[model samples]
Target: MEYLIPFNRPFLTGKENEFVNEVFRTRNLSGNGPFTKKSQAFFENRFGFGKCLLTTSCTDALEMAAILIDIKPGDEVIVPSYTFVSSANPFILRGAKIVFIDSKNNHPSLDENQIESLITKKTKAIVVVHYAGTACNMELVMSIAAKYKLYVIEDAAQAIANNYSFSDKSKKFLGSFGHLATFSFHETKNISSGEGGLLVINDKTLVERAEIIWEKGTNRNAFFKGIVDKYNWVDVGSSFLPSELIAALLYSQLQSLDEIQKKRIAIWNQYKNGLKEWALLNDVEISYIPEYSGNNAHIFYLIFNTSEKRDNLILKLKNKGILSVFHYLSLHKSPYYKDKHDGRELVNSDRYSDCLLRLPLFVDLTEKEVTHIINIIVN
Candidate 1:
């Protein structure tokens, strides 16, 4: 089952071991240690995010957002169907009804135009997933949220280092627009801490409570800072913080973010150029970066004309000792949610479910390996 080229190989910044050794020397192994603080501060300073907290996983961060937003039973939350389950699961756990939206005609991002019609009196929030690191139209999204007085959460799990440019060419980081945002550092992401995530609080009013929730629903952080005489449980929360070891590993990659992004975008361009002609002849659509979004090269995929063709390409790559794979299926059609879904059909989401194929892409993947993958596809 092994392949010469796999879908992903986590890249290390060479300083990871050095950082881990420093953690050991300091002997502060729990969460919120020096390493954790440094990693959190890096995001806040670099991206201008209001406040940051590292979590055990992106799911935990989303859960924290749900709590902060106070999602209640029967409240409806609009979300795109073309995404991983984590995008919607957090709100569902809070007893909210998920009103699934369709992907845009030419892009996998949720259609911003269709959002308003779907909002109802029960609607409480909108969850936007920046699929393959492309930002959804934040200007329109924020305007709609403002009009409806709804919460907006950016699920930036695949979008670290991505920037969204407005029409005027002013740029803002992907996770900075939403009232709340979350990120992932899974091995497959641009950054890796083995498994880690972050919650960004753009609403300063929520900063104090977010810190409390991140610290197991206690006022312990305030107590340590001498703001409170004694810490006690004051809110509903969980043990969301990841240990210092995860932060140490994550901070090492933060220092190398610029280099990692430059290399990835270069590789992405190579695939686009090499496959341009063959893809046209074969009617295979290579991925496109939206005008408003800068490429972070989080994924490079092809959309075949049919499901059979997509499946065949996977087998062909496998036969040649390479590995390629598909991404999220329509969550509205998922087994657990299928019957629960209203009868509306999401055409683009379903098409992507069947035809989109993600090729092998990672920092460690060499040029020779990439050319081999392209040649196989074009052949």
Candidate 2:
């Protein structure tokens, strides 16, 4: 069924075609070409990340993080239940036990306060997802990881340009806080390369090994750089790198990040202002951005009072030629993991699973379209 307003439309900067043409002219189509280098350099220079590697998708990036951390059988990695399966799949594939945590009461971010109690002798890492491009409490998360000597892998798939401000008046990008982090450039994300992702290495120790893993577990990258006489397989990995075409497309999007963010934030503010009274009256909750975190306006979701009401709203929007949708079901309660899950109930994660509704939000969505959505919701 087609709708006048779709749930999402991928936005393209006018320069994408030109950049791809440049890649063609250069005759380097595979990964780690000039375009890939430029793309990696952009993130590393802008965010001061130790190293960055473009991957086929965020899942691949997370997989690289898992490999870098050496997750083995019986190792437990704590993660929020209310997130995309990619967050947990990587570690699970390494035979690590995923200790699912609950979301915060007011936001979809993992509850940082409950993290310590979940840590056991088997715990090796804490993976945190910055939902809707907002920052999780990195200070608390990092302190806990430090105390326990655990690795922190941030699933910053939705948080590309988002930043976190500290009490010292310093600011850090969301992906920069973790020892390893991942970012997505899927069509649904703030930035798009059709399908692409980035792996950020903040812990300098992982940089060399990450490069090797990114190059199909070989020392090929070092060989190309004249550091190694001959490249050979030294570690376990897969083909995770994106082709140069994807990097070219992504670099084009990165060039327009500021303009895209400006439009999105404006749309977000309009929704907030328009629906404030209605949300209050209806007892619905809007997406919450903490003071320390900078909003990139990646997503604008509403938490309805009940699942029935939420479902009704989706149907109503559909009837009106609009498209709104819901996000992740609790992974702990997922069919594949339900029986495997321990008997502990994650209250907030379940609540979000039942009630959170994501409205149409994209760089191309106009104010008129946004107002139309708000009118349907408020009325």
How well does each candidate superpose onto the true structure, as a TM-score?
0.99, 0.99
Clashing residue pairs in candidate 1 are: none
lDDT of 1 at 193: 97
Clashes of each: 0, 0
The lDDT, on a scale of 0 to 1, for candidate 2 is: 0.94
Candidate 1 lDDT score at position 105 = 76
> What residue runs in model 2 are displaced by over 4 Å at the alpha carbon?
none
Candidate 2's error at 324, in angstroms? Answer: 0.2
Q: What lDDT does each candidate get?
A: 0.94, 0.94
Collision count of model 1: 0
Candidate 1 minimal-lDDT segment of 10 residues: 370-379
